[model samples]
Target chain A: MQALVIAAHGSHLNPDASDPTYAHADTVRETGAFDEVREAFWKEEPHFREVIRTLESDEVFVVPLFISEGYFTEQVIPRELRLEEWDPEKWDSDGTDASQATLEATDVGKTIHYCGPVGTHDAMTDVIVQRAESVTEDPNVGEGVGLAVVGHGTERNENSAKAVEYHTERIREQDRFDEVEALFMDEEPEVDDVTEFFESEDVVVVPLFIADGYHTQEDIPEDMGLTEDYRLGWNVPADVDGHRIWYAGAVGTEDLMADVILERAADAGADLGDAIERVRAATAAGTGDEPRSEPEPGAGAGD
Target chain B: MSESTSDLEALLAAADDGVAFDGLRLEHEGDGYALETPDIERTGLDEGALRDALETVPAYVSNWQYWQREIRGDGTARRAFLRRCERAPLADDESADHQPVADDVALSVPERYDALANGIDREWGQLCITVRFVDVENPDGERVYDLWHVDDAGNDLADLEVYDDPRDARALATEDEDGRYRPLKTAPTLRSGWAFTGLSGQELVDAVEFFYPATVANWHRELHGELDVDHWLETAERQTGIYDVIDELPREAVDWMAEACCVDSQCLRRREWQYEEGDDLEVDGGDGAFPCREPCSLVVAAARKWTVLESEEERTYELELTTSELNQLTDLIDAVAEGRTDEVREADVYDGANRYRARYLRAKRFDEDGNLEATERDGE
Candidate 1:
């Protein structure tokens, strides 16, 4: 079985935008679970259309390294890769139906199992929780801390905002923090209104983006007055009103997501249990032979 | 200096209209002297209070003399004086002595200019004046001052006339239109057209510093390399309404799309746009339209799926399947897709078979209801 991760590449103007995706892919490739683990991109090389042509595996599992199940997953991925025939009318309003559910292969000789985008998985909430905790000055006590899940909401699509709200609820259910609010860059209950949303003095804002790109690195920080500098992860100490605000890197960049990717592959019939155990055993033995694959010569190393 | 009644009358007689002493008088009080401008009727000061006010007369006279000297030499000081006159009476605590040296006075203009002033105000915007220094060589080098309209913000909004004579620049500095100080420019540089003419370099820079503070701050930031390309790009993006939606996509997808087609499809000019395999997607040919301005159908579809995944509400479905039954179900899916339905039937006896059968039944019901067009089409 082979694993193929698809992502949107960073812009030429801003190279660091796609760094997290490449970093995550490199981490997953080191696990040696699949015969091959290669990443394809929509904006960079190798292009998605050409990526499949390069594949040698008869059975492949494709996982979208996306934050949501938006236009890309339902339309673009299926159409480009010819994974499945998607008819909006055939499925329920939620776009999920038993007949159309997971791991259905196409008629071609290749068996491709497409998994849900990494962002929507139940385990992703844990990643968000971890991100919030990592940046919080005091993680043990969430009494005064506010968790703000910020997303790029659009008037073009209500689903975009809904996805953010979904994650907000999941993180809120953990009951770890005093408050959890879903905020957006372009919509109401906006990022600018974060100060009003939280009564707590310490607010941890985790961008619900898949990659630490422009919105995460530039827009969010500028809006929050976290820093004028644009980079990934924790910004310099910042505040809104009198509340201390901590900014985390995008939720998708977390290392635990490698595990989630493997789990998704497992659900798609990749059977990673043995390979994971092998990798774990190698790590436990301190063998220093952790099967980390060297990137292809032309594959750009993220900064 | 102390003077008798005759000396006071003589000083008042010599004062002209410009001195602002039309109805002035002086009166002696207990152990002090009272001097009144526009008379005691307007001032409404009692004899004892007027005596105390007389002591401040020396300081006020000295301040007025100093201001006259400064205003004569400094165009900015003159403008400040004129601005103060246009407004109401200066508050007792608020005086020319207390005003800070305008920011532009401290800024050293490039050596090319004989005089320049850049003033910035958050409320009123920016003002700038620059006079070019020219050296003409004959037998002796002759210095010439030519005032040029240079938009320091790079925004050509100031309607300024180039002046060969320094007097013209100075005259324009003090010029007033409609009772307000003219040449007070407003942002974002496209809308401003006011240009103050006659001012000394210090005054011009000071006016600019006073008028458009943010522009000066931005200039300072740029000069120090504190304003990075990303910051500028972000600012440009915000102003132009060019959202960073590309960043919202996965990094790999961004790279692939950049290689495959123009990621910016909104500006595509062609009626029926198609991304040719080897076509250059990066170049927009100055039209803001890349070869493909919008994502390809594939990317759009995938993005839709991603959105759905992101927005979809979570619901837990618990299933109790034995190891063998789970394996069988997994196997059956592959077998069915591979057209090995016989193998699927063989696994029908598994513990999860009833659940799987129920799904098939539900699907059959949907199919009978004419709701499963995709399934029906696939079967055909």
Candidate 2:
């Protein structure tokens, strides 16, 4: 069956980064729709490279949880995974079985196809809007309240902050916010530099970053002075900035991340199969490059 | 599918010795081992030493008394306090068995900081610092403020916040949906303050002292955590010759500060609080001049500590400071320039951060007319 790999910008030192991937993988596994599902991270274990060769399903789908279409998604994961290119230019215009045959001949799985990162999807706007709504009790999200859509913007790449453009645009189209603006931890529209841009004293700072660190703790508070009282801690368990300012945890820490992976698999055209035959095929052929004794059925496949 | 981190933590606790996470050999699976963190390293040890080290933790975590009460009186006395520590010193026989953290000690702050700060000095990579403001009510007869500081610059840290106010403080969550911040809310009535307890080296102390007590405390700390320590100096029990909490003390005392200051107490004014976001320099090195090579955002080196002090009479403000050793070197430089090297012996007494610094004679060279040219930098 189709297996979904939720790739993330994970950290080993801090558990918060990769935990979302693990948590969503658990939820996706519980659905039992996919024969296999797993997580891979840039910074932590089950790294991007080894995780790909370990997948057994005929059709494998990868969905990056990164918030930007920057270098990581465009260059790093592709080079490391050895994934076949998805450019349609090499294909016959008639949409025939030619490419499939070419892939099969080249020893690339005919069923293997990759979709873009889930972060780039239009559906993610809904997730952001929902997250904003979830922070407030009422569905009324930030009426006259300044919603600072905080992104980990960097001067190293303008495109790093450009994702905020897409997010802010999509979020605005949904008509869910009273005032929505973009702020960065590093780049222009720098969070601290333009806190008044939101125009509302009641500002909700949402980290579009995968995991929280200095920006959330020092930069955000030092600029806003919202948490001058929360000394010794940059992060205060989702609540410490006071009601005048609300902060949503990093966007990847959501339950619906698994849904995004499933959507990516559908886009990649995953081949679903009965559990019995798939398990038998995976065990007999040996899913890993080197053959190993069979696992005790479903043991450790999801990790 | 079954791998939950909490489940892993529970298993780590239950196992007799080190156990692989999710029963997968990490090295074979191609990821370096992920089951350890130096912060919780003590949890991995045998029972007895683990228990003894852990016993000090709850108290350390729950209050700031250990930090602010660091017994800063006589020089030899301070050394004795440090040698003794807070909890009983690890028995000499048990010293070898003490594995203080949960992971390999390589992840320890000092070790990591050494590696990272070395890189910074060598101009390798940028550094990041995580500053946390931890305020816990030590209802065990004291109220103290603590700042938990971590950085890429190795284990050189500073977690020093003392509540001069005699009031107890605790964590509270107030949620207002319409407000900007969420579940972790402070009472609009909550007022407290915090200060930087440590600096990079003794060189940075004077600048910190000048900036914080002047700029940040007036604007922030007086509105947030501890009232000014200067407030109770003369009026506090130490000055009144009162060894009592209730009898002769002023009405607004929150908790007794164990140390007595021999300074005059004065009435500190409470300013009207305002926080509309200020204009910016796009700090955090956004210039691409010095970019972060890693995917993570590189942070600057600074300790960010805050405290919330609530009061019936006094107001709280925020305090933020950074410093460096003022120029004590030129005296020695002048000593050499004049060729009278024997005067170098006098320069040794200028210990700025060490609580004693000698006032060096100011240097003023005469212009065409012999007069005070204001060319000398004063020493405190």
Candidate 3:
């Protein structure tokens, strides 16, 4: 049986930050594809590992519901869950796979499949492009203006910045933007390069992040040199220098994300194989020295 | 004690008789008691004599009001949920302005309603009220016009005034064209000292009804003076009909061919505000033009500057302060700080700004002990 676990990087400081995680949890649950589905958080309650203990599933699929895959997916989630990294068999004993044990260190036997964060997914660019289209009165494809995919890049992980870089190239492929550039807070191809790389008179930048936190609020404006109003729902015009740009609210504001997770759950059903064993043993023996052992690790497996 | 009553009567007789003891009378009963006039009615008692006279009465101590003021230097502190109510019975004496048993506020649909009604209707655009002249005359001093408009939540919207003739009443209801209804401009111009007045209560109410657009019907008036109740009610009803007819007039059409401007209430207000603002001498972006009549501009400017709404909301507001008020806030603060106003500290209210916009006002006196003493605010 295959089960699914959704992990979110929530904030302890804001009660509103957990709203999306809880919303998506309900979304995935409505599908009923996995024998069981649960959520874990970087912050707030039902912690990342304890969530796994409660599920007790042998086969579990972990999905990162974050904007970037760099530090959190590559180092942070692995450090917390105690599981092996993807393509572990390919790595030689150069201390590469040695750190992979943290990804899977539970009393119960379990096989986990971790998916990329949703922001790194192909479908997300459509949402981003759709968001850009909503703001401008007319999106001139012929104009050589650049679409800068700005994400909250952190020094903590190389993998996180790759997601933004990949998404930027995919966006450029659509040709609405003649030039597509990826910028980061932690890594290079930075935001300062934007004005230098700006090809046309007009520009529209979208901040690819989970929530409108510090990076989106203070840092982005500082990077862009906006002194006045929070540039929401309004665009900047050229001759105004940086005024030739506008912003879309963080992608988490999309109302359809709840539907996306529900769809992903339906596509990920692997049917529980371990729960069958527990049920058969209970019928055959009828009585045992021990009662049911803390819902076997793969109890949520097999829809 | 019974002889003391007789003695009191004898005191009046002795005063009339010019006998000695100075208006004092004595009775044979009750061991020869003496009587005097009530202390309130004293005419000839010297200050010292009055004190001495007051001392003679044992336990004649009368209590007057006193205050237990608790002032903590720090003082930082809709509706429409009614279910049901029975209809009120008709008033026994509707014409009586002073309802004897009712709360004094019963006389208030604003006590200034009379002054406002007959004074002038300076409000513009959305606030067009009607004015109709009624024969109903006020008994107070000048036999002023008894004008009323709408009924406010509690009292009638009446504006009474001592007019020389019908012309003064006519001057009040004249339309102001250069005020709030200027659709071409996003920013509203400032206005002041403009009142929208009507000749009669119902006429003003009808004008208000036309601008506000409500289906109102019943009309009443409470005139204070020697008019009979029958005439008061009849006049109140007549005021209603005439005012409603006046409300039926349409807004004046704008003429593009001619450069001439017709002054409507809104344009008039803006024009008036512009004249007043000219005196500030420092409104050239240093303080940003105060949108005296434009709330949206005021609210937005405050919002952009303040982290919390209250900080800006507390900005001292000086609506149409005369040259005198401007002096009082700035010059008086300077004078008081320099100990120039120490003799009596006559009470006044003035809003102060932090070199920026005035946020709020502090009026009324605080004694050296910080007790609020009664203040006489002498102003026009």
Candidate 4:
């Protein structure tokens, strides 16, 4: 049996940090592409250390649902998952090749294929462009508007900025928008500088982060001087210094992310052929179970 | 084969005609086995199919089988606790003693299980377990559960934040409603207004673990007679860094530590570890569903501070106090120790812990520097 595991950075203080990962897992499960789909977190229960033990499948494919290929994807994830031993001194150091898409290892008689994070996927350029375009109903949303891709860049790891720059360069090459610039939360050209970086009267800032948590929902918007009141998701275009700014939600929450995750799994050479055959055989035998359903009670509606 | 598997095989054998066990009914039908539950029934099942069916009969079996085998073995505290949540058949008079939070004893087995769709809420520590079916209308469907803070049990799912991932429950457990960080996740101060809805059996157990780490596992171990409790002395000896000084704490001080941190109001876990091996503390270990295997880090940290304070030589200072004032001091200590300081109303001046009463005492007895007037440490 084949299983898909999405590894993410879950927050001990923010309930919404793992929302996109669970949503993507649910979407993947609906497709019946893998025998099982589970999510593991770095900071939460069923953590990387124990997620492998929870799976009954012989073949496990793990995809990091992060927006970068830095400390987490290269080091912490692998070490925590027991694919590599964590050297305490090496915590602050880096040596793993950032370009490697998949790392295959064998642990406890299971073939573990650790796929690259969804953030650095080539298709993310399209996700970012789609987020920017879908932020407003205005037909000329992308026309004459400068697009700023905001990432949670850090001075600790330069690779975090690389993924944002990659999408920025890719979008710039498309030449669909007037200008595409990359902004960071921690590094230079901060989110607060979005207005100064773009000379256009209208600018669309798309957060290149994973989930719509503190950074996307509060920090970035506050930095852009949009609203002090923290409301989730895309906001109405706010006027700042004669510039109309449209702040889109985090890119990872998009529906198309399910495709990107599958793409990354496939690119990692996860044996999808066997899973596809199993699903087909089950369907032919009329044994394919109905899609899992959740109870809808008179209580509260979930996000 | 494992004992449980053998027991299952025996159960299948005993079902040659018809037998009901743990809300499941099975019988022989034309060389095949027929299985039935209160909500759903299936016939024409061979041996393998019978086991598969037993593994998943929707209303109870499938949801119960995995967790029963994985997280809960027979006779485990967690198994008993989960059984209690589902209002599973009582084995003896002992189980009948602790009534369900929402008593449905009048309802039949099927009626009780069916009512799960509306959710039967039960409290475990600060967690509220809502046991309900995934699809009440579907016979072949399994049960799904939700875990929320007890305070959020009756709140609308819309009013409280809803979560499906077990990992997300950590955020709900890490702080109070006011957002003050809770150093002890097991403290009764678990923040309300968040629900982990629509969880499968394993997901429910996993979410509980996130909310109160190792609670289910420890409970399971305790029930299986495998809980290895490290007493206060051993736990203190194992401590390193600045915490190593905790081992020097006086024996009576350990009793105070247990009183302050291990009781039901302070922590949800019953203290299994004692002052030393088999030397139980004078204080009650609490009535929690799970057992704490050792003094938690908070206990150790607090013990370290207490150890240093205990090292100070005894100091005596005479102070005149009215009989009422002396009684008030006892009441104040009891209020603080029982964590009812906030519960005592400020307007109720008769209460010793009342804000105004406490302020008056401080003004009368405490010097300008806030030290007790006319008293000094012997060393000073």
Candidate 5:
């Protein structure tokens, strides 16, 4: 039997980090695509170290429910999951030139296909565009609306910014939105100075994050002048400097993420088999062939 | 018949007599065997169908198969501990008279299984366990379990913080009822008002590990004779850095240290380690559910300080104290050791450990530098 393991960076302080992972696993489980759909987390129980042993399936597809291909995806996860024994120190000097291809390993009758992080998938461009469009009152985002794809970048891993930059450039190529800018929470073109980089009065900020924990709920909103009180929920078209900052939920929380995770698994050579048809049938049955609306930011947006 | 088949038939016959084997009931009715669990009931089942039902229902299968094959014999301690957690009937002749004690309600087999649908609450240390049988009709179904702080067991899910990730249990386990940070995760002071709901078997075990790290593994090891216990002497010898001095502590002082730190009041793990190999300390190791295989990091750190204090040469000093004051000191030590210092009332002056009594003793005996007026250490 085939099993799908959605590995994520959960949080001891915040349960919201692993929420979306569970939701996606539940969605996948409903499809009867895999005999078992399990979730593993770096900071949560059923940890990466022991998660694989809990499954009964021999063929397992592990999809990292992360936003980028950086430290965790390359080093910490691979080591903890026993996917490989790589020196973490070499991760930086080795540079981003390391193969971004999926890593597969067979041990003790189980074959684990480690797929790429869902955030870097090509289909995420559509997810982000859909998210940006779903939030704003403006029917056409191209008519003067500026889009800022926000990522939590760090100097520790230069590749962290690449995913956001890649998707930002990809969206820019479509030339659908009036302007597209890649913003970072940690690095240059900070999300805090978002209005300074965009001239459009209507700016849609979509956090390129896997979960809506501290960053999406507090940091990004606070930085964008969305809320001063540091609250839990946010209303759209938040006024900042007399301009509308239409803040969408973290892009990873989008329902299409179920599709994206499956796509990533498929790209990793996991035979979708009848799961592809099941996903289509589920999509048709649930959403009725319409584009998904913007999701509310909070829990179940896997951290 | 094969031994396994005979055992299955024996189990079936036991169930037929209305014996509920950990919430599973199989009865030989007028037609065929009627197999039932908390979640599903398959009626008109022949011997093969009954076997199929038993093997398919995870709650039943995991309980019986694991119990019969592993827990019934000279099984691992972890398996035995798990049996205790489920309130399963004792398998050995040593406890032959002991049976699973149910409530006063003498419900029928079907009614009994139905009663378990809401979950059977059990306590493991400070954790409240709720074992739930989810969709047992499905062959690949699971025996989902939820873990909450024992204090939060009665709280509604809506009123309490609901968590799905087991890792989040660390945060809940980090503090006490009064919000003070508990340095020891297994200090019997795990904060309440949080629950990890709908966890799989592995997730349940993982969450328990986060709350009380290595308790399950260590307990299993100790039971299987695989536990490598580092006693006080050996553990102290291995210590380096500032803790290297811990080896200098007197053997009797080590006993006091165990008394101060390893008991049930201070830690929820039974102290399995002693002063040295085949050498037991005079102090009573706690009766905690799990065993402490070695001195924890906290114990080692505390032992270093204790070693330094113990190294000081003993000195005699004359002191003036009333009989009441002398008794109050003993009361104060007892109160502090039992974590009841807060319970001593200021108004209750008659009680030796009362706040006002303690203050009176301090006022009369303590010097300005917070030292006893008539006493000084040898160095001083």
Candidate 6:
């Protein structure tokens, strides 16, 4: 059994940005589904290149801890890891091809399963709903509360905005809040236009970023007229206009995503049963008793 | 309540109502509440009692106002003000504790220097002092002292006044201007070069290291041939857009250049013909001449290397794979790195695989010929 590597874009300036990613990886490692679970970052150590060199396992599952399938996923990641050839134009023109969606192990000599970005998963809507519900003083009382899904939309790529829009629709379908609005840091509808989106007195903004980096920690708060030191989860309630704005942490850090990550691995043809059995056998051999079956799904999510 | 407390309360009430008690008056000047009681005898209280009462009244009033604001509106400003009050020494405590021990205390020159240094360190927050010895043979061996006012982070805030006489510097340290100490200027400068006549290189380095601990660490790193990348990067990141390469000079060198001659080729000082014409060769100093903006040789060399490093970029990838698949990928990469193509089986041509092959071949070719050009195409 090989390792499950979570790739994240860590920041040099902000420590809080990459903390959640490592915390989530630790949770998934505790599941005993893979031989090892590790975190590889772009900025911080252990750097992605350095991490690969240290890996003992040949078969690796890499789950991008990103919000969208854009330049990073299509060009940068493959180029760095020596993955198969990919045309950005083709992928951009008509989304991902079903045949090329999950890279087969036989094709690359060593099996490397490239899963869809964790943020783009269908299960993320549940996480988004939970994040929105967590910040509201009264989740049941939706009278004056609005949910705003904030994403890092780029003018360079329409897919970035589309991913945010997809999640917005999913969250809206749940009908948990009075109103749900999709907002972007770049391009329209901008995050600054948040006030005009709803007539509600309370706005619960759930940042759809993978990490709580500079954009989530600093830029978003500043743009929304909130004071600095506002953090992930329920922040110190900021007064924008006459309404109370509550900001939640990035969506990818949610506990539910642990299950999504496993699902992603399973979709990429990982044998979860075999990995679980190997762990259980190793534990039983060491302790002289059978270990608990797959110790709960969200074990390491919030840590 | 004590009799003194009751008397103080009554005095405060009279002061609040804008009423004059005896010959003294308590009035509100703008936002500040002040008691104008220059003559303590006119208030029918002893000098000590009057001073105590005055101190207690303002704190009580301020506390009352703080609470009033908290109850009526958001208490952000009130809370901050209260915090400031808590941190600041009370008026009575300052008066009692800060009183000088004696006007004339006979002390040796060394003792006086120690006392002055201690007083400046305690009163002016963070301060760095450098003393340069000059005219060692003269009866009164002259020395120039440079004092740098620094912030809590040890970042230089200002170049405090230089002094040739230790007595004059000590007097400035002990002087209490108005009720509070005089604040240092907001901007920093390297002024009045302290020239030493006979000090060796090691002695000068030791003197600098004593004042600035960061410089000591920098010196240690230099001995081991290590660059302080963080410090260099911090200076580089401050500038925006396209800037002259000279602007990227190391901060210490820039500071040195500002106080010395222009190293820039275009400068009149660098041109020998300007000196030949009996032109009083001008050195870089003062506002207009300081901070030579032209590309100097030192700056040009550093800028060339900096641009190369800054231009290169690295990317990271994230992939998902089954347990067995990850192991095989590892093997494939290892085989390629070691030039064992026979061990490296052909995988389906994908973006990652193709990229890996090119990198592997490049490395392999480089190892074989000691140059990547051996594998490069005609125009490439």
- Local distance difference test, per candidate? 0.47, 0.39, 0.40, 0.70, 0.69, 0.48
Tens-place lDDT per residue, model 3, B78-181, is 00000000011112213334532311122111222243234322222323233211222421111112222223212333422333222222223322234212
lDDT of 6: 0.48
Candidate that would win on TM-score? 4
Q: What local lDDT does model 2 show for residue B13?
A: 49
Could you tell me the lDDT of residue A210 within candidate 1? 78
State residue B147's C-alpha deviation in candidate 6, in Å. Answer: 46
Q: Between prediction 4 and prediction 6, which has the larger DockQ?
A: 4
Best by DockQ: 4
The complex in candidate 1 yields a DockQ of: 0.01
Q: Score every model by TM-score.
A: 0.41, 0.37, 0.35, 0.56, 0.55, 0.40
List of clashing residue pairs for candidate 4 = A300-B157, A300-B158
**For candidate 1, lDDT tens digit of each residue in B72-145?**
23222223322222221222123333433332323111211122112222112223233321222211111111
Report how far residue B244 has shifted in candidate 2, in Å: 67
Candidate 6 TM-score over all chains jointly: 0.40
Q: State, as a TM-score between 0 and 1, how close model 3 is to the true structure.
A: 0.35
Instruction: Name the best candidate (by lDDT).
Output: 4
**Tens digit per residue, CA lDDT, model 5, B272-351:** 89999888998888888677766776787788789889988788787888887778889998888788988877688888
Give a tens-digit lDDT track for model 5, residues A1-303.
788889887765554666678767767766677776777776564566556655556778888888777767776677656665344443332332222343444222367777667887777787787677667634346668899999888766676788888889989998887889999998888988888888889889999988887778888898888888567555698888867899987887766578778877777676666554454344322323333332322222221
Give the DockQ (C-alpha) for candidate 4. Answer: 0.05
DockQ of each candidate, alpha-carbon based:
0.01, 0.01, 0.01, 0.05, 0.04, 0.01
lDDT of 2 by residue, B286-332 (tens): 22111111111100000000012221344443322113222434444
Per model, how many backbone clashes are there?
Answer: 88, 62, 72, 2, 4, 30
Error of 2 at B134 (Å): 52
Q: Candidate 3 lDDT, tens digit per residue, A145-195?
A: 667778666565555566677778888877767777888776676764556
